[model samples]
Target chain A: MAEEKKRIQAYLEQLKNKVETQENYGGEITNEEARMDIRDCPECGAGRAYHKGLTACAYCGFVFMDTKLTDGVNIRKENNS
Target chain B: MSGNPLLEPIHGITLEDYGAACARLGSGLSEDDVAKALGVELPVWQEANLLWPERMKQDATFHIVTLFGQYFGQADQHPKFSGLKASASPEGAGNIEKIKQDKDFYQELEVARQVAYDYGLDGAQWIVDNYGIPIGDFQIAASLWNDQIHRDIQADYAGYNQRQAAYQAKYQQLFAEKQGGNVADDIEF
Candidate 1:
């Protein structure tokens, strides 16, 4: 009975260690690709999202993403899909 | 500290519910009204530009504690900024005595606990004023789950520390035997 108890205790300890190790080092699973797909630039259809202080067109260098619109306010598309 | 003796229990009324209440109460009234009424009633509101950052902080503290208690079951245990000292042995009778005697420990604990209560009361008041409930009817139920979590964690860490100390002592003895005399003198550059 004592030997059996010891064996069980050792097994439990091993399992605990394994769980702790996994928790400590196991990488976080994330949907980076899905996030990229969603946050893609609206105007250019290019995946480049340049949030550099200015919310403007990256490729065309258009201020506020438009020059014709004097207000310089970027209009968010209702459904930019 | 003791909450209002006349306070009644609020069933299922949450912090978000209180925020909605605050919003609704302030909705019909214009910014000018808020400035006027709150200025007379709570002068601090106008002085701070009606930027209730304090209210937001209070809400955030309550939310964090509620979440911690609900998920991990340590609601009563004081939430701390840093360090492992908070995770001490819950078993030792001396530990509580030490906490009582220690000024720093009491101060830290008081700050965390006070913030929790302040936010909780604000939330409760918001419900009463906005929900149009009867006086002393909204009962704020305080749970003990989070405190238990902190106690359990501290107990586990204490046990682990004991084991670690034993291991270190055994290693030291073995090293002293292997190197004869002072172990410190045996170190090679």
Candidate 2:
């Protein structure tokens, strides 16, 4: 049992230094790869935030990035609010 | 073999065993190491590894075995193996307390997962990098909320891997349009 704990600790330490994700599917999907617009609103300079369903500027009503909100695997409109 | 060899355990190694073996493989253990630990020859282990996924593809029911695979892969307490653990979920990977406080984050992760796959990216790893929620940990947490939903998620992985060739082709084409990437997507000026 002690040996198992030590091995787990060592393995986790190794993972902390290296993230071994699937490589055959190409590289990590950066925001540009997803075409995600995460820029602050040029109009009001407010950070982009996803609230209710819209992903626009929090303070100003600037819509930079938005997706069609639907009842998904976890996210639900009724329950979250 | 069992009633149906097609669905039977590979070389008498149960599906849970194969899942744990894979977890150990992901943990940087060599193929020979896993084969030895599992008390099988390297060639036999290799054959099982190859055929197991092929079986997943051929699984007519699709999700049943694979869902359990996902869970077993992360379950350190799984009965099949001792002193061998391959779960990649860090200590903070899935915090129940955090899940209770902000369910939105989890929901948003689900949404991100969908979008990443839509863009032909590996949805599991994408969420891991972006939200710090590994798929293994996600499986456990989501299972707590609802088992059926968790099954659907695992089933999607089986479907996705089969269709990944087509998806990767599209992603490569689309990604070529963009410049290089920054690991962290920062504000664009």
- Fraction of the real A/B interface contacts present in each candidate? 0.00, 0.04
Q: What would the TM-score be for candidate 2 when compared with the true structure?
A: 0.40
Tens digits of lDDT, candidate 1, A1-81: 675566557555654564444322113456665332233345665453534422344665433322111111132222111
lDDT string, candidate 1, B40-146, tens digits: 21222232322223333556346433442232222112122011122223443243333334533333333333332232223322332333221111111122223
Q: Residue-pair clashes per candidate, as listed?
A: 15, 0
Across residues B84-156, which tens digit of lDDT does each residue of candidate 2 receive? Answer: 5444355443442354245444554555566555544567766655555545445444544455445655879
In CAPRI terms, model 2 is classed as incorrect
- Residue pairs with colliding backbones in model 2 are none
Give per-residue CA lDDT, model 2, range A1-81, as digits (tens): 675566557555544443454452224556744344345578898664455333345566665322222232343333221
C-alpha lDDT of all candidate models, in order: 0.32, 0.53
Candidate 2 wrongly placed segments (more than 4 Å): A1-81, B23-33, B57-74, B80-83, B86-105, B116-126, B130-132, B139-189
DockQ class, candidate 1: incorrect
